[model samples]
Target chain A: MVNNKGLLIVISGPSAVGKGTICKELVKRGIDNLELSVSATTRRPRQGEIDGINYYFKEKEVFEKMIEREDFLEFARVYDNYYGTPKKNVMDKISNGKDVILEIDIQGAKQVKRNYEDGIFIFIMPPSFKELKSRIVKRGTETQKDMDKRMTCAFEEVQQAKYYDYIVVNDDLNSAVEKIYCIIKAEKCRLSRYHIDLSGFKEEL
Target chain B: MVNNKGLLIVISGPSAVGKGTICKELVKRGIDNLELSVSATTRRPRQGEIDGINYYFKEKEVFEKMIEREDFLEFARVYDNYYGTPKKNVMDKISNGKDVILEIDIQGAKQVKRNYEDGIFIFIMPPSFKELKSRIVKRGTETQKDMDKRMTCAFEEVQQAKYYDYIVVNDDLNSAVEKIYCIIKAEKCRLSRYHIDLSGFKEEL
Candidate 1:
């Protein structure tokens, strides 16, 4: 019952594969018991990005200090910036019985896996690589070379799906969200997660 | 994908814990893709029992012959009657992409586990031992001695919940059914079970 702790859901997928969109839809459903884990990053906040909501924007020195303190669950340097998941916030929420969903890239997901083996790892996938290519192309902002690079990265990411506990294909928006919801509900029912009070049975005996 | 074979869901629990009721609800919900595996038994049919629907009623000779053929996924003899799950029907349905639900006792479930390790095993449980005892006594057919024997058996069966992948408590009938439904839906999205066609990616590469 209340003895069951909340789940740490680590979701990952290649860029343009709708991982962000699915997470948004899941939140929009108003599931009060769950929260999205805010990531800390040394990268500059983009236009319209909120300081805490979009990302916990941090100075390079502050981020490095955090790494020294082992404050991040998982952190990495990409190109010129550092990004990582803060350990305290996620751990506090889970201990307080709030499920936290962390949307990350494959590399960050691997880090999470090593640190938190009990977390549910889900990989969001495109319906087909053809569709994925078209979606990348449809974005207009990315040049052909950029698209190719993204696609190559995606190909490699998909190979890592075998390590995930669940693979959700984002063929349709609603269906994908529904599948994730079901996964959360079902995971809660796992025998290892649920605590059954057998005191009544002991009394009877 | 059609290549994804159906799941063999083995459900078991203590007696009078609402396993039958939950299965009936699951079927009534028009989960057409799933079918119940009809058990073969040598017990005499009750007043309203049908040949195939209720049980595959068979003569003792035929039941013994089935045993000799190694045709049952799991079988057991109780008192003067022989009961078992015929392997062919279940296997055929699974190969054809139809999920099969096998409602059996813990003993039979353990037998099935030895024969089929890939099955999703679920244990249905009562909210508490008090509730379970009340439910058994409410049936009005059991004498005090019968009730004591049943309660003892149920106590023993409850200990086997540790072996199950999922444990659903029948606190509310509808909620229990919904949990099982979600479990099935979520299981289909497992990376191991799902077949993703990456041919498009190969072509792109």
Candidate 2:
């Protein structure tokens, strides 16, 4: 008896909660059967970005069409640009016994939870409100009004943490990574995930 | 905020399935906040057994009265002796922020689940039927008739594994111990367990 399929892991929080960095570290640990889910975007690629490697670039019209056909697991249009996780890419990897992790914002996480309640939903939390504000301020790219808006958004997202299965405080980087890694290992032991073949045990008896 | 109460962890399987061994190893790992729940039994303690260390030796009448008062979390009468887990002992530790683990048989586990569904239930499984039978035979204390009865009981217990939250196979002792350790750590991260003080994170902002 084996777990024939992999788990769908969603890491979510406010924009500056460090979900991206944690996911990067987990992937770089060289666990062979784990993968990060890639998103399709309607925005321009950056200088060093590759077409399929960085993001699945699509025209706005084509992205809207895919949304109509439900090709994306979760998608949202933000200030004229569309971003979404393609359903096929994530589903195929899971079927092939590779755990696929998605680092998305609160809205997309809620969408994925609605569609698949069995996936592991983890909410990464900043140590405190002060720390969250400082992280955003350190980026030094936003105006005072914009930073205030982001902090308000972060406050709203922190309230949504209760809905997720696990809440990991992103206080220490190594400790946070270790906790998430433990969560992944523990999920593998869940009885709901395994197709236990007890028939052979009984038959041989 | 901290999780005010500790988790009630139940490790269960058929007799001789190594549930007791795993629990011992986990406690011996010196996780300071973890403790094993001691059972009160009407049977005479073996030579050199301490009163509260190995088992809480109890008189039959006292055990019966306690059961009537709903003092035991779960209890059962086996062959002439009454064995049970005292509710106060386990609950007090949990209230003091120490996780209490119970290593019990399948029937006792069922009773605990009925009383407290929030507890973490883990089932220990042998690698295969052949390995299970050989382990029983190697014990060399049971008669042939008793051995057959125990094997039949084991076969029945395997079917109940589905009802548990996690299933750990005892193929390798170290691996099984490590998996259970990870499970404990992950459970602490569960949203339901933590008294999340997001209120501070919001109010301070």
Relative to the true structure, how large is the alpha-carbon lDDT of every model?
0.89, 0.90
Residue pairs with clashing backbones, model 1:
none
Which parts of model 1 are misplaced by more than 4 Å? A1-3, A44-50, A78-80, A195-197, B1-3, B45-49, B195-197
lDDT of 2 by residue, B10-102 (tens): 999988778888999999998759899999999999999999998999999999999999998899999999999998999899899899999
| lDDT for model 1 | 0.89
Q: After superposition, how far is residue A47 of candidate 1 from its true place, in Å?
A: 6.4
True-vs-predicted CA distance for residue A33, candidate 1, Å: 1.3
lDDT of 1 by residue, B91-167 (tens): 99999989999988899999999989889999998888889989988877888888888888888899889899999
TM-score of chain A taken by itself, candidate 2: 0.95
lDDT (10s digit) by residue, model 2, range A78-163: 89899999988899989999999999999999999987788899999999889988888887789988988888889888889989
DockQ of each: 0.68, 0.73
